[model samples]
Target: MGLESAVSLYDQSTRGRAGERRAPGAGARPLRPHAAGDRSVGFAEVRDFHVEVARRADPALALVPLLVGGDPSKRGKVIAASADLRSRGLVPGMGMVEALDRAAEARWVPTDMRRAREQSGLLRAAVRREVGAVEIEGLAGFYLCAPADREEALAVARRLEARVAEQMGLPLRVGVAPARFAASLVAEDAGRSGARVVVAEDFEQYLLAQPIDRLPGAGPKTAARLAELGATDIPSLRRLGLDRLEVLLGNHGRSLWLLACGQDPKPLRVRRHPTTLSREESFAGDERDPGELGAVLVRLSERLEQALQRDGLRAGRIALRLTYADERTVTRSHSFDAPVSAVRELAVAARALLDRIDLGPDSVRRAGLVLRGLEISGAEDRQLDLF
Candidate 1:
């Protein structure tokens, strides 16, 4: 998908709104901008761009890109409410009550991180299946084209994007470069463009003039600090020298310094298989009821089962992570004597673990399920051992 196309889709809400909103268990309704033509960029475009840039720079250099799926607003209600609230100076990460007070007409719905992550997983699967090799960065995105030549590499990226559109109903924006920071910046730019390739040379020049806030790791607070120091853009910040940057930004400062210089030491490693398959959700409000939480867990386990089945994999171990109201976290896990793919079995194990934790009502914020000890079905014909 070209950048212009992606933006057009984002702007094209179901009924003319900024996005389509679907409440849990509610029928899909037309709200605003309707789904249009495929809005994703071609992976080939990204791969070629990265190859071209790498040839111009050091051939051994790698490209690491990042993407935030369902960013700005994870849901339609959230987007609508955020906009209504933002007009009155209310922003994200703010107290819900304060936001409502600011915009009495606003309507806000909680975020569904689980849905977002599932969407992300679909995209990631496409990347892995189509691309030559990939290294998943985190829950949301991954890195690609490791020391690959221009032609073969670009082909892989193009295939990846195509597969993602075919498998998932989400559009992807891609960037490519010899450096991770540069790749991320360019991908975002391309995502916003009507074109696919944002030429690496042009991307570098573009990076120099852009504000620090545009950089991957620079948050609002860090941007403010940089602004106070007379370093507004990447180029200006680059002149601050590593020692001075380390003093001001500490570890983050040093990392920023490297990125500003168009270098990232993070290497890409190919995984023959995923280390784990997990689903996590962060509630908009704290909940105390185990039943309610268990219901969510059931939903998550179902999703995980679908994911694993889609990939033809099974889990040999299960793990649960729960974060309480006090910001304290706990984790528990159990190994299965035999691989399991059934959602009921997974949920049963998960519920047992949940029962052991003390998550008072109004204090539990997030919960996650991670499946490890993966074994490819039929790859090994060992007898099932139930311990």
Candidate 2:
């Protein structure tokens, strides 16, 4: 978009929000004016990360069909597969046994997450060298904010891709667009060692031409439901106004409607650390028993603890969200004097916060725990209390 249109959109998006309350470390920052006039956003993906890792590890596997995952004999699922296997419908998340059946001669490479993490860090550093900051998309991609117009954005992406390839020996495919989500989808569709650039004028037309399934959150079930509603593409989806979509699909439907209307971009984030970690579960029915709710909290805390340990991080705040059967939600939060990573500590804090909430006649249908104010495990000193 041009400078005027970009500023207009930013104003529209942020107009009426004054003194809005936001949870700490929630990644709630909105888009702001760029430092150097208008800029475009882009996504860069490390094409076939696992397959490339396997090839780099052993040159002999360069041309072979490789399936990366766990033991098929133990009900493992496919993590990544070679291009040939993917073309044959052997995609990630398929059962290893099924994947093996599809490509009988495909070599099985055990998932090397440690190596992947190391490589991903290297890739991010390389991209940041060219672009000041980036938002990491899982372990294989990055959301980059470029310095100037569409052409400059495209050139930046190209330079980053080439530099990453030279330094890390990994190929990157980039997509530049006026919107973040559009950039992500375009990057996913871009050819190996190439970039796709979508200008502001072409943004609307490009989005309308994309299949409905291309939008995130429009999974198989939602896509089928949309098809049943006679909406098979972005244009048809947009025709269903915001109110109708909200009534039919709830919040996700509203979000989809917004994206369909092209309200998806925001200022890019650096995201050096994950903003928040949360786990939630819905009850089979309305639940009033405190014991059941407490058990769920413990389970969620344990899951968060595992994630914290995996990431070598700790949380300084925890928020508990209780969703009533009527779809209303109440959230209560507490901050820790010292960051916590233990399940026991998290569960205790959550239970304390839960007790503070006045649960009336309403029964909770879902419970969730959000961990924020995160930092590296050893970043701060702990205070010891004398008994």
Candidate 3:
């Protein structure tokens, strides 16, 4: 996109962002990658996403240790720790008090779900305009299908990095690889280190050397299990032989092996048919009952499911939003194993997201569900995430 066009797009998408608050952190250098693209899949992750949203909106918060989450006085957990706080060893999921004890001078900022969603929507739209195919990883990350050839793919990525940083005021780390799993890992390191583009021919040698524990499904326990079996790295796992790995780790082993060798065939699901569906309810009064909130979510899910099916669509992502009596907003989302159009599946996912919120004894003044990252039914496919 041209500079004038990028500015125009930024203006249209970011009208309400003048009041955005941001946390402290220096941006990284732009990554320039040269590699052939053969069915290349790319990922872009916003560094310090929630905290950046806060910092950009509020200049005073810049260079401040900001915490995006519940009431620190009431002992809410830190959903997002700013880069400044993180540098001080404060991490997300730590209690607000603990975070403050770690960095007693930090600021507690209530999360603005509505603003975050708007920013995410704007970023997705921007990517869709420059690049044809895109997949949203919640509010902070994006998966893009690079152009078939390498040159155009790299150009799109360069423009994307500049566009996001220039237009959105959000720094992005771009990773282009043959497979999604590898692309995600690349994005993580690239976000902090620099941009990385791995060609199809180099993927196996590039990805397999990384430790086996870095993959999503290979958490602490899974990594330990693999370690016990002497399958500590992708290359070693491949050398361990797929048959034995399958017996030892089930589908997870199979998936990891495929990811390592760039054999996973999950397609880049683009948002060809765009639709944003949301359901919400305002309570008569503050309701604190978990069951009541869950019931509302079920009703919303039932309606959302019907809407998706009626249109022959499925939601690739689902977010649960809540408004507290104090007027604070919370939005938590979960990616589906696969895009889902079923009520049971959607509700189950929604309830699970609701569980992630720490209501404690707080009353919910309003609640809602937003379905985005949409795709036409059967338009693309994805492998299930192994636990």
Candidate 1 differs from the real structure by a C-alpha RMSD in angstroms, to one decimal, of 19.6
lDDT of 2 by residue, 289-326 (tens): 98899999999898889777766689999999999999
Candidate 1, residue 132: how far the Cα is off, in Å: 6.2
Query: What's the ranking of the predictions by TM-score, best on top?
Result: 3, 2, 1
Per-model clash counts, in order, read 24, 0, 12
Total clashes in model 3, counting residue pairs 3 or more apart in sequence or in different chains: 12
Q: Rank the candidates by lDDT, best first.
A: 2, 3, 1
Across 85-107, the per-residue lDDT of candidate 3 in tens digits comes to 78788888888888877787878
lDDT of candidate 3 at residue 89, scale 0 to 100: 82
Mark the regions of model 2 whose C-alpha exceeds 4 Å error after superposition: 1-37, 265-267, 272-387
What local lDDT does model 3 show for residue 335? 87
Q: Which is the leading candidate under lDDT?
A: 2
Q: For model 3, what is the alpha-carbon lDDT of residue 86?
A: 81
Single out the weakest 10-residue window by summed lDDT for candidate 1: 32-41
Off by over 4 Å in 3: 1-37, 87-89, 148-150, 192-194, 265-267, 279-387
Q: What is the TM-score (0 to 1) of candidate 2?
A: 0.62
Q: For every model shown, what is its TM-score relative to the native structure?
A: 0.56, 0.62, 0.63
